[model samples]
Target chain A: MKVRLIDLYVAFLKIGGLTFGGGYAMLPMLQREVIDKHGWATIEEVLDIYAICQCTPGIIAVNTATMIGYRKRGIVGAIVATLGEITPSVVIITILASVLTRVQDFAVIQRAFGGIRIAVCALIVQSVLTLSKKSITNTGTVLLFLASVALTLIAGLSPIAVVVLAIVAGLIIGKVKERRAA
Target chain B: MIYLELFWEFFKIGLFSIGGGLATLPFLYKLAETHPHWLTAAQIGDMVAISESTPGPIGINMATFAGYQAAGYPGGLIATLGEVAPSVIIIIIIARFLSNFDKNPKVENAFYALRPVVVGLITFAGLKLLQIVVYGEGVLNGRAMIAFAILVVGVLKFKKVHPLVWIGLGAVGGIFLNLGG
Candidate 1:
């Protein structure tokens, strides 16, 4: 059955609406909506889509919207899906910017922001834990993790350098693993 | 003229921002430096706060907000479009390759390798954000810090808890207990 444009739009809308923190936190919700609810994508596809989004430039969530939407419809599907993903931000932020300019001094607003920032941190930490649990499965991955954290955090190495090195390292490791399996 | 400049500026931000949404901060700061009229340092801090808490991608939210602040709704629209264009274009070109891309040993390995890096970048981003939130101004107050710890523990107790629930609880706690201010 072909999913209607509006249905696709609504799906992203719901995903974007419920999502807080950032792109990583949105993945579980995205999987539930796109895979479990609609069956537009499978688990493996979702993972690969996420990987692709990670490697590419721009917002991961918006890229997810484009890629998943394209899968659901085509190019047009991508646009509407992106629009759906961003609509909430546009509305909410626009309202915030206008209204916050006025009452930003209010103690309650500061307190609320203080509260929200903590929750955002907790969610981000949860995502970090989930990823590490999955990725730190081998010695090589462990070394890579430590090296990466050092390069990025301590040395202030450019993230792109870390990404490029990881790709090459991954290729070598993947090949070695494949040879062993074969 | 200003809209074109906005699009071009954000287009560059979208193009080079690697890792994830948090990576956009430096580029935004650079923008602020180059164009002081475009945004203030204080505005960027506020943008970070709002983007983190809002729905959609943080990068996109940032582009829209910064863009709006620069040139209203039209600026917001263009900046967002510019920010997202690279990913949309790149994904479209590469996604066709990805279905079978996973089968290739190198592609598979590269992705496996990339996961930790993604995790690393995310962890770094989270900690930095926590540092700012928990210990703003490089000085801490016992009560606020305690409130934060309690909230974190309470949220972490539920295995696989919905993130939205955390957001709601944080809001309620913030309002009721004055955890933030």
Candidate 2:
């Protein structure tokens, strides 16, 4: 079944406009709209896009929209989805920029922003938990997570360095496992 | 030509700052140093708060807000376009070779390695934010502890509770508890 470009724009607009949390927070909503609501893609396709977007540059949610849109309607589809995804942000942020001082100066707004920050922090932890369940499946993955956490948190290693190292580690592990199986 | 500068600056941020939105923070800090007019350190913090609190990707929010702040609405649009330009191009190129994209064993292995690392990245990002929100300011002080506890408990108990609900409750507590800074 074909998906209309307009539908692509509208659905992603919903995801972009409504999702409060960042990229990871956008995942479940993306799943709901794309897979459940519009039948745009399957579960595996979404996960594949997730992985691809992570390794690629740009905002993960925005990149996901680009990929899905491109799949649905080629380059034009990609543009529409991306525009839909970001239009709300541009408008909202532009407005907020104008009044950012007024809001920050307000006692109530300050406190509210602070509270929202903490809650957002909690939500990030929740994302970490959900993601870990799927990624940390074996002893090797467990070790990677531990090493990565220590390197990033305790040792203050750059995340890019960690990502590169993980890629190399993955290749070595894959080669070793292939040899063992053979 | 601040618009041109905004476009160039954010285009670089988009191209190099891999690992997603939060990853762009360090570069933004550096930009604060080099181009203080684009965004100040304090403004960066404000941008993060506003970006996270509002809708859309935090990266896009930062870029758009910074652009608007620096140049104007046109700057906002241009900066966003710059940020996403690399992504649109790269995804299109990869999409062009759609079939061979995922089937390669090397690519599969790379992702196998990447998944856990991303999990690690997200965990680190969470810890960093938690430190800032919980400890950066002493606002989570004596009485505010109760609000914090309630949030944690509510989140833990109701796994499916939308984060917006937590944010809303936090907002209410902010006013009631007179949370400032």
Candidate topping DockQ: 2
Misplaced by over 4 Å in model 2 are A1-15, A18-57, A68-77, B1-59, B62-75, B137-146, B179-181
Residue B143 error, candidate 2, Å: 4.4
* Candidate 2 lDDT tens digits, A3-112: 88889999999999988756677988898899999889999989888877876777888889999999999999999999999988999999988887556777777777
Which candidate should be chosen as best, given lDDT against the real structure?
2
Q: Give the distance in Å from residue A154's predicted Cα in candidate 2 to where it truly belongs.
A: 3.4
Alpha carbon lDDT of residue A137, candidate 1? 86
TM-score of each: 0.72, 0.75
Q: Which pairs of residues collide in model 1?
A: none
Per-prediction share of native contacts kept: 0.64, 0.66
DockQ of the two-chain complex in candidate 1: 0.48
- Give the least accurate 10-residue stretch of model 1 chain B, judged by summed lDDT: B96-105
Clash counts per candidate, in order, are: 0, 0
Any runs in candidate 1 off by more than 4 Å, and if so which? A1-61, A68-77, A175-182, B1-59, B69-72, B95-99, B168-181
Lowest-lDDT window of 10 residues in candidate 2 chain A? A118-127
- Checking candidate 2 for backbone clashes, the offending pairs are none
Candidate 1 per-residue lDDT over residues B110-146, each given as its tens digit:
7778777767766665665666666766777565577
